[model samples]
Target: MTELTERIERLAIQDGTIITAYHALSFVRSSDVSEPVPAVYKPSLCVIAQGAKQVLLGPESYFYDPGSYLVASVHLPITGQVIDASPEKPYLSLQLQFEMDQILDIIQQPYFTENTGHKSHRALVIGQMSNSLHEAILRLIRLLDTPEDLPALAPYAVREILYRMLQTEQGNTIRNFALLGSRAQRIVPVIEQINREYTEPMRVDNLAKAAGMSTSSFFSCFKEVTAMTPLQYQKRLRLTEARRLLLATMSDATSVAYQVGYESATQFNREYARLFGQPPIRDVRRFLGMNPQ
Candidate 1:
């Protein structure tokens, strides 16, 4: 492990809910990062120091380990699996949530800058990690070890981290989310619509209309906002919820499938197996074992 990572892990504790520190800090650890957990990744900067993880945004996938860092510029319902980890080398991560206020403040300043006009990228990205960025993350994590110092110094440290991200390949990713009229702005309403009506049978043409473009333009922008197409976005949501219901209650594959709007149990099972690496019953069984209450 790097010196900075070692120091950060020394200070974090697993409280179950996302750990909120003096300046929005948390250190993530697991004995063996084996499977993906269901979670909504809000706009944030998540850096990994050790081990590796894969995030599925719809049908598309992303992996970030020591070699890369992740940035989620919009709130996205995602499936993330830790692709690499072991008892001796567990997964370790540091995540810092972003605020539009911070980005807006930065842009209003004299030195703030970017060349993001008419440019667009996926809302989430896994780019090659840089040594400078790594060191900055380490510094942010280390502040947690010194609780006394955290009270007076954590805010400045957090700002430094944000400032560094604003100046990297992540700059446009951050700016579009904050500034109005960026492609990110055009897609926010459409994304919210999908999240709200995930349980219903959705029509791509309708969503394309809501997003205010021709079917082709909407499809292009939607794919850019989410890593996958609209149908893929809804599919993940269905499977994820079906898996949740099967675990939370005594529901068979058919019932669980219906609960999430599947027309056929056979189809649901096939898709579930494809996504979670097992059929409904077996996958739920494995899921329960891993997360038994």
Candidate 2:
């Protein structure tokens, strides 16, 4: 294994995720391939030091490994799975989360050029990893050993990593999401609104007006970035939350369905089964059987 991979595996130690002293950074280790797990991914850079993984955004599948990096510029509900891993060489990776303010700060630097066009782009992107970017990430990871230096030096190292990322080919797309008044930026608030009020009845006209776009334009741009319509996005959010509630509490399928804003138990069952490949109760039972708490 490469030194980078070895260092991560040593630090990870366990099979799940480890939040480092640098709160924005986290390491993940998995010893075997996994089923597709759904969750809302925040804005972050994901790099794999060993093995590979797949991220499903709507119907699209994104695979990345040591040679490449994946960036989620916005919060997105996605299904992720470790596709290549084993106990001997586990899937080891790190995620560095950042805010739009950080990207905006970098864009203001004289060396950085702001793209003027307002075309909407996919929120999730994969780019070829450069040597400089890799080195920057390594430096950041090494900071875990020197906790004293981390308080001061971690920011610089993280900044360098972002700087190197912005120099890549997909950098322009990343910048567009953070650019002021851009369509992608405008759509962000709508996404946030959907996330905040997903249980409420959605009106396309109101959302379009809030975004300052026409109905057709809003629909096009929203789907362009999220790969799903606004209604579909809300449904996914609802079902995802329903699953979480069912697993974490004593609520039955019917109760959980209503809790997540489903008006009809029958409709909820049909939709939940379609997404999870089994009825709610059966799926929950299977999950609990596999991972007993």
Candidate 3:
């Protein structure tokens, strides 16, 4: 095994995810390949030290392993699956969450220069991992060994990691998302609005106005970044939330259908089945069988 994987496996002795001493950083390990699980990915950097994984956003699929890193520049609902893992090696990885302010801070430095006027790119991107970036990540992980040093040095290591990312080919995409008034940045507020009121009825024209763009321009930019139309994105949000609610509460399929804003039970069942590959009640029962309370 490589040093990076070994370090992660050692730190994350148990399976599942753990929030490390550094609050923004977390480690994850799984012993076997997993099923597609839906989740909302925050703005963060995901590096896999051992095995490969796949992330599905809309119809697009992204796969990454030790040689690459994945970045989610905005909130996106996605399906993630571990395509590779074994009992002996397991799947070792770490995710470091950061805010737009952090990216803006790095861009303000004189050494960094990029044209921020570029049009929006996909919010999810994969970049080739360089030796410098790998070393920076290793240094950050090594801090767990010296908990006391984390306070003084963790921030610097994290800063270096972000700086290295800014130097990559996809750096322009990342920069534009953080730059004020950039098309990508302008779409962020609208994304936030959808996330907050996903259950509410959506008005495309109103959302476009909120982003200060015409309907066509807004629609194009939004799809360019998210890989889905506004209505499709809202449907994803609704279905994902419905799955969570069904598992969390005793609510039946019909109740959850309306709870997530579906006007007709028939439409909810059809869409939910389309997204999850099964009817709501059957899927919930299968999930319960696999994981019993």
What TM-score does each of the candidates earn? 0.79, 0.94, 0.93
Backbone clashes in model 3, listed as residue pairs:
none
Report lDDT (Cα) of residue 155, candidate 2: 92
Give me candidate 1's TM-score against the actual structure. Answer: 0.79
Query: Candidate 3: deviation at residue 95, Å?
Result: 1.0
Distance (Å) between predicted and true CA of 151, model 1?
7.6
Compute the lDDT of residue 101 as modeled in candidate 1.
72
Q: Is candidate 2 or candidate 3 better by lDDT?
A: 3
Which pairs clash (backbone N, Cα, C closer than 3 Å) in model 2? none
Clashes of each: 0, 0, 0
Candidate 1: tens digits of C-alpha lDDT, residues 145-177: 677888788777777777777777667766777
| Candidate 1 residue pairs in clash (backbone atoms < 3 Å) | none
Best by TM-score: 2
True-structure Cα RMSD, model 1? 4.0
Model 1: worst 10 consecutive residues (lDDT sum): 9-18
- Best candidate according to lDDT: 3
lDDT of 2 at 265: 97
